[model samples]
Target: MREVAIVAFGQSDHVRDSAQTSEVEMLMPVLHDVLRRTGLRTRDIGFTCSGSSDYLAGRAFSFTMALDGVGAWPPISESHVETDGAWALYEAWVKLLTGEADTALVYAYGKSSPGDLREVLTRQLDPYYLAPLWPDSVALAALQAQALIDAGRTDEAELAAIADRDRTAAAAHPHAQRRGPRPAGEYVVAPLRTGDCPPIGDGAAAVILAAGDTARRLAAAQGRRPAWIRGLDHRIEAHSLGVRDLTDSPSTRLAAERAGVFRRPVDTAELHAPFTSQEVVLRDALALDDTVRINPSGGAQAANPVMATGLIRLGEAADRIQRGDSDRALAHATSGPCLQQNLVAVLEGEA
Candidate 1:
């Protein structure tokens, strides 16, 4: 396989809400930052892929407005996904692998505050059986938490510890939505509490990927180190909640192996675990231990803008490599209920 590396990455400040700004307005500055960092303009990109949902904006073709942020007056080759920005990166990787494009731009954004975010998320479930019940995301996650406790895999204190560690790490992230000292306390829903939940927030992010000679050229021109993608893979598990084991994330385990997560001891990991309990499941499935620094960017517990959360994981993991923070890292993203769909990527500085 041809090597593909992330040459540049940029993200906007994650806010509780962008009162006066539209998604396009929020994206424009970050897009400009990406170009500035890479020493490349819109014209230099060979392919563009974006991840955002129409439901986020409560309107169809919401991504069209975001195109304005890219300055598409002359038009550019582009595609989009209804999934997280990580999926867009997956699409971009495929484009590069096909020899169709050497350089690609991937981005995602969401303003979940405009509507009932939890209620909206239920739409992601099975329309026939799951959707009719209208179970909110946290309630489903609570079920997972309860199952873990029942199975003796973990307890409430462990969930609190996960929350404490992630939010404590967020102290270093200027873009994090929630960061402060907290006493790990009682459960908001029997064994899960406010601290165990990620705050609802609005955010956007963009990343630039280049492969082979083009990647080298871009790195040289920008005087920036590149985070090479050592391996990337994703997997999906059975959707029926009752049919699958909630305590284990089989998809994540498979995806991690396929992504070569164990090839070289990972120094750090950025996991997209929105709820505190989900982090436990992911950590166990990925076999990450104390040696692996988890969520240095504070992770989803800090700022989770739905579709944008996964891409943020990739960007943050790359940032550590670009900044010379670590030699090897893993970036993981999860979607659907009880971690139904998952992606894992092993990254390192170009050797």
Candidate 2:
């Protein structure tokens, strides 16, 4: 397979609401920023892929409207996913590997402010059973949190600590919506405090991917290190919430293994665990020990942009490697309710 690396990443300052902005408006600056970091223009990109949920926009083919910011006037190879931006990155990775593209631009965004964000997420549930129940994101997460508590995996205090650590770590990330530790607020749902849940926010993120020699060249031009894609894979659990184990994530474990997460020690990990309690399940599943620095960018718990949160995880991990802060890093993204789908990507700096 052709080697690929994330040479640049950029994101907007996440906020509770971007009421005045359109999707194109929110995306333009981020797209400009990522391209500026790499000194590349839209026409220079060989392949372009984006991720966004039509449900979030409350319209069909919403991604196409967002493409106006991409400057597709000249025409180019492009695609999109109706999920998280990290999945778009996955597609771009495949394109590079196939030698169909030497460089790719991947981006994703979410404008969750316009609707009942919690209720909007419930759209992903089973249309037959779960959808009818209308278990909003936090409620479903609370159930998982309760199960973990019952299984003796973790309790409220530990979940609180996870929230504190992730948000505190974000103090240095200017783009993070929630920076610095805050009190674990009152429960939004039983066993899940307000702090335990991710902030409903709107934001956008973008990344530039280049293959092999092209990857090295892009980084060199920017005077940065390339966060090489050492391995990458994604796996999904059973769709039925009843049959799946809420206290564990077998799919994440399998994806991590397939992505070569265990080939060697990873110095840093950026997980897309939107809820604090989910972090417990993920930590156990990915086998991330105490030694691994997790969520230095505050994770989804700190700055969840819905469709863009997962991509930010990969970007945060890659940024560490690019800055020589980490020799090896792990990036993970999850979609669907209660982490139903998981994608794992391992990154490493050059020799």
Who wins the lDDT comparison?
2
Global lDDT scores for all candidate models: 0.88, 0.93
Global CA lDDT computed for model 2: 0.93
lDDT of 1 by residue, 206-296 (tens): 9999998888787777776788999899999997998988999999999999999877789999999989899889999999989999999
Regions of candidate 1 where Cα sits further than 4 Å from its true position: none
Question: Which pairs in model 1 have colliding backbones?
Answer: none
Question: Cα miss at 233, model 1 (Å)?
Answer: 0.7
TM-score (all chains, Cα) for each model: 0.97, 0.99
RMSD of 1: 1.3
Where is the poorest 10-residue window by lDDT in model 2?
Answer: 68-77
lDDT, candidate 1, residue 162?
Answer: 86
Q: What is the lDDT of residue 16 in candidate 2?
A: 93
RMSD of each: 1.3, 0.8
